[model samples]
Target: MPMSEEAKALRRVYQREYRRTHPEQLKRQRECTRQWQRQHPEKCREYQRRYWERKAAQENK
Candidate 1:
């Protein structure tokens, strides 16, 4: 089921609060993602390709 607008808003608020309170953790997570992408460049390119494709399709709609 799709999330209601109120639920989505609440989620955004919670996420913003969490990030504000956990800067170190978020920084570590981003570093880990960067490391993974560096170790898997091909996989990352494939993922980006699919992501852009989906984004383009959404915009066309």
Candidate 2:
């Protein structure tokens, strides 16, 4: 089903708010993740394992 006009307007407001607040946080998170992956491959593997576990659960549902 298509989104209603009110839903679309709300999405626009939410998108703008998120862009203002989240870009720096996301950039920092990416930098930290990359540093972790570089410094500790084993720790990165554990993160990947949990990521796949979550993906599997979502797919099953």
Candidate 3:
């Protein structure tokens, strides 16, 4: 089932508070993401290219 807007908003607030109180966890998460990107440079570049292409297409609409 899909969450209602209020439920989604509350979840977002909870996540923001959790991240605010867990700096180390956020740092580790970012480090893990960076490591994955380093191991898949070509994939990351392709993803970025596609992302910008979509963004540009949306802007032109």
Candidate 4:
């Protein structure tokens, strides 16, 4: 099921509060993300190429 706007807002507030109290967790998450990107360079390039293609198509429409 899709989240309601209020539900999404509550989630954002909760995430913001969690991050405020969890610096180490956030640091670990960022490090994991960087490691994944380094290990999946081709996948990242393909994702970026598709993202730009979709964005340009949207702008031209």
TM-score of 4: 0.80
**Model 2, 1-61: lDDT tens per residue?**
9999999999999989998989998799899978978999998889889999999999999
Pairs clashing within candidate 2: none
TM-score, predicted candidate 3 vs. hidden true structure: 0.77
Report the number of clashing residue pairs per model: 0, 0, 0, 0
- lDDT string for model 4 (1-61, tens) is 9999999999999999999999999999999999999999999999999999999999999
Evaluated with TM-score, which candidate comes out highest? Answer: 1
- Per-residue lDDT for 57 in model 2? 100
Give the lDDT of residue 48 in candidate 3. Answer: 98
Off by over 4 Å in 4: none
Clashes of 2: 0
Better of 2 and 4 by TM-score: 4
- Indicate the TM-score of model 1: 0.87
lDDT of each: 0.99, 0.93, 0.99, 0.99
* lDDT over C-alpha atoms for residue 48 of model 1: 94
Q: Which stretches of candidate 2 lie over 4 Å from their true place?
A: 1-33
Q: Would you list the clashing residue pairs of candidate 4? A: none
What lDDT would candidate 1 get against the real structure?
Answer: 0.99
